[model samples]
Target: MDISLKNGYEELGVAWRRGCEFLGTDYAIMGGAMSWVSERHLVAAISNAGGFGVIACGAMTSDLLDAEITATRELTQKPFGVNLITMHPELDQLVNICLSHKVGHVVLAGGVPSKETIRRIKEGGAKAICFAPILALAKKLVRTGADALVIEGMEAGGHVGPVSTSVLAQEILPYITEVPVFVAGGIGRGEAISTYLRMGASGCQVGTRFVCAFESIAHPDFKKSFIRANARDAVTTVQVDPQFPVIPVRALNNEGGKKFIETQHNVIARYRAGEMDLATAQLEIEHFWAGALRRAVIDGDVEFGSVMAGQSVGMVKSEQSTADIIQELVAQAASAFSDHEVIRSNP
Candidate 1:
């Protein structure tokens, strides 16, 4: 590498080195744990490429998650984390499974985790990472022994909050400095990553950008949908009735999403007529997309299955090797520093 490029890379590294140290990876970048898409292959590839990879333990049995951790270890010696949904029935068993494998980090997502849960992860010798959509939750998580925080905005794929990434960063990053905070949602390029690092974010998490990685097992049709999408095409699922409250999930607008809206309407009507109770109606709405993500990712049913993607999906034009993707992001971040050096010298 040229001397200037080396300096640029060094400068970029200085900004996120704290995150790198926390994650034990060469780069501070984290591969967002997307259900179905973030399995062993993609996870290992991202870790091997110097970015931290996290396995999405979505709806997986304890036995399945155990096997996945074992398999991912075979492909890479680098560190990775596992994302466990907070509401998993076997949450304790899953935590034990990860600890038994000596997993270094465990991310508790979906909803707020109990303080005891955080303590268990820490006592088990793994760092606990939690998702904080707002500043209050971020502080509380930190107080409860969260080792790190990921503030994901509404632009992310899958279930998301109401705030945008930029707004959340502004609202939380300045106030929370007790632990490493990673920004996610709508982050596509290294330029954006660099911007966040400058704003005191320890690192950034990227999901939609990695969905089309060459190592990704996402079906060809699923990858193609991402390639052809525009930012506007990725919209959040709608909730017809506030009483039946549906957690908004961002994905490519498809028949599945439309069906979800219709499903909500039907379920809410039945509840209004006293045909089913509120809990049953809510479950019906939630179960509509239970197997939909897997259908698109594994079965290539892009037309009707859930095509979860962040607005950053528009930036993913084609499939690239995991290593190349990481390299491109690094170069883009380094170039920002190089440009600063050039301007300073000329001035």
Candidate 2:
């Protein structure tokens, strides 16, 4: 792969171009934060390797987040960020914890972030990154002071939105120029990253491929599942009852997923029988997977734990170092640039 003419993918849009500058990293690639999977070791390794790393604060208390941030700082002196879910009960305190630690970046995921949350992050001298589910929301997030946006598609692992990456890029990128937009979901290789950057994304966020990283603490069985599975093996949960809201989550199909379907049916039937109210029944359904991810990631219960994974799980063939993964993606992107140049020159 002759990448001499690629020029390090400098053709990406200005917003993402500035996003790299804002992140203070050599590359704009961000290791998407996955619950129970992203921790100090993986986060530090990603940052030290030149791509951005974000600590996933899924259901973590303020004290835990503080300790995680302190530990990550000790591992690598490079810049890294913390990903805080919007629905977190301790949202304010978590933001305050990041502020107290002088964290460089805070990514707000799970839902649209409130303006006050965005303001607090920015006012604390940290960059605020929000998830944009649609073009309108992308523009609105910018208006609310989001420094950058991550447009994640349904093909992503864990909790996901409805749109695909390709369609979201087409719909949101051309219109929203206020901030850099990082495309996520279904991005498996460097070529795809290059394609999104050319389409106006500032960079890309990847999760599934990194789940098996050598630095990742995910259980061996969980990593093995990712390695052995193909894209088709990852499917989103379907809503068994329309009355109860079901936010689709992508994961490797296993015994846990099968049981979750049955569990939902029973819970919905109880609700319909007037034995339980809507909220309590919904909570019962949601709580089914509460501690399940941890079971898969830490306890090696792949058979009955949530093995959250994106479609890109198919490309994760082995457990490599985080540096190797970043280098591979960078090299692939550079090669794609060179290939494009060759075709343009020939034409």
Candidate with maximal lDDT: 1
Question: On residues 1-347, what C-alpha lDDT tens digit does candidate 1 reach at each position?
Answer: 77777888988989999999999999999999999989999999999999999999999999999999999999999999999999999999999999999999999999999999999999999999999988998999999999999999898999988989999999999999999999999999999998899899999999999999999999999999999999999999898888878788899999888878888888888899999998999899888998899999999999889999999999999999999999999899888877776778899
Q: What is the C-alpha RMSD of each candidate to the true structure, in Å?
A: 1.4, 1.7
Candidate 2 per-residue lDDT over residues 179-268, each given as its tens digit? 888999988899998888888888999988889899999999999999999999999987888888888999999988899989999998
Q: Report how far residue 46 has shifted in candidate 2, in Å.
A: 0.1
Candidate models: Cα lDDT each: 0.94, 0.90
- Candidate 2 runs further than 4 Å off: 1-16
Q: Count clashes in each candidate, considering only residues at least 3 apart in sequence or on different chains.
A: 0, 1
TM-score result, candidate 2: 0.96
User: What TM-score, over all chains together, does every model reach?
Assistant: 0.96, 0.96
